[model samples]
Target: MILRCNTGGTRTDNFAFFIYAFSSLFAIVSPVGGVITFVSLTSDMSLDEKNYLASKSVILACIIALFFAVTGQIILNFFGVSIDSLRVAGGILLFVVAFDMILAKVSRESVTEKEIDISMERSDIWIFPIALPLLTGPGTITTIIVLMGSAVSVLQRGEVIAAILLTFLITGVLFHFSRRIYKFLGYTGMLVFTRLMGLLLAAMAVNFITIGIWNIYLSFQ
Candidate 1:
């Protein structure tokens, strides 16, 4: 009975971890944004070409996310930045992103109009704006780093990595079906969804800030 209880507790903790990781990454990545960008960029391409681009972009994003997850702590250490400081800074950045999302803006902080215009001139977009700023932008990178920093054990790190992989997989699938999703959601539905996600992200940003501040306080005491 004790063993069973312990196992159940572990399962619950893992579930909670996964949910937080998934939701935070999802809000930051904003697959709906990916759908819009993918559809527009691939409007002139064939279905096969669209599928190929989507796959490549998603795979690239997954690689980038994992790279950050592994190296984030090292990078922070090199920079002499504490995880709590990163959390505070990242929280501020995320809050700004959430504000843009709430306003139904395309998040110029992630992808600016100039970048999109330049991308239009390029033939291969899978590596450019699509994979970089579109799918795995600064916001997403910071979120992953923060989450990785918070991970206390190998198992927890693995769970965070798994969540990143799963989120990008879902993102790729959504991009592959971008046209269908756009038609189903329409512009208004998409705006509503973005706003709702923004609200959630804003709340998360507050939580991050609070935790960061509390940690900083504890360190001094």
Candidate 2:
């Protein structure tokens, strides 16, 4: 059996795959990176209201994510879509988002402050910006669909679910303490982290594009 070792200790391939799944989801979802925006938008809310919003947003995001992960392939097939084409398109979308993130520009996929302002008057703000684009935008959905499509085994699929749950659990906790996290990190620290995550995402995007292209080429041969 092939084995790998790190400072932590020796690990098997399964463990490595879990780590890959978790990290990929974490990088794309980026709950911590969105804390500042979350805090800013919720500044006028009471503590209880903030808590309610956080909980609801997480619940909605989790549901949406699970739905896409489970039904992603069926949706693709129904639409006559191929996983390779989705991957290439999704990778390009991710690259655009990452480029904006690296430059500290609010990604078009994400809600702008003005949009948030307009959305604030609505009761479904939690469903819209908080849960929709903020937590599971096009890029996030694309990643979910692509990853689920790539899974070949029940165990691997379980690992993906585990990763999704873990990522969102952390997301809820982070939003619960959004104020403190924002206070601790401040704007500059948050910017640094956002940029770092952007770099990671950009790398992932390139990997996705490369694999998609390679597979598509192989299919023709």
Candidate 3:
């Protein structure tokens, strides 16, 4: 009976963790925003060309995300920054991003108009705005680092990795069908979705800040 109860509890905890990670990552990545940029950048391209670019961009983004997920902790340790400090800083940054999303403003922290212009001039944008700032920007990187840093066990780490992979896979699908999705959702629907995500992100940011502060306080004892 005890073994069965423990197993059930573990499963529940893992499921909850997965949900939290997925929601946080999805909110940060903002596939709706990606779709808008993807469509704008590839407006003159054929459907096949757009699909190819989407696939390439998504694969590259996944690689970058995974690399950071694996090495983010080490990088932080080398820089002598504690996870708690990172959590507080990342939370503040996310709050700023959420504010921008709520107002339907494009975040200059993620990408700038000048970068977009440069990308427009490039023949291959998969590595430029599309994959870099558009898909895996600093916000996404910080989120991944914080998530990975908080993983205490191998199982928890696996769950975080799974969440990252699943989020990127969904992002790829959304980008691949950007035109169809835009037509279906239209502008108003996209704005509504972005704001909803922003609200969730704001709540998450608060949670992160609370946890970080609590951890820091505990360390003093």
Which candidate comes out best when scored by lDDT?
Answer: 1
Model 1 lDDT tens row, 184-211: 9987888898899999999999988999
Residue 131 in candidate 3, Cα distance off native in Å:
0.9
User: Which of 1 and 2 is the better model by TM-score?
Assistant: 1
Instruction: Report lDDT (Cα) of residue 127, candidate 3.
Output: 91
TM-score of each: 0.94, 0.93, 0.94
Give me the overall lDDT of model 3: 0.86
Clashing pairs in 1: none
Deviation in Å, model 2, residue 50 alpha carbon: 0.4
Location of the lowest summed lDDT over 10 successive residues in candidate 1: 1-10
Q: Identify the superior model by lDDT, candidate 1 or candidate 3.
A: 1
Clashes of each: 0, 0, 0
Candidate 2: lDDT over CA atoms?
0.86
Give the worst 10-residue stretch by lDDT in candidate 3.
1-10
Question: Candidate 3 clash total?
Answer: 0
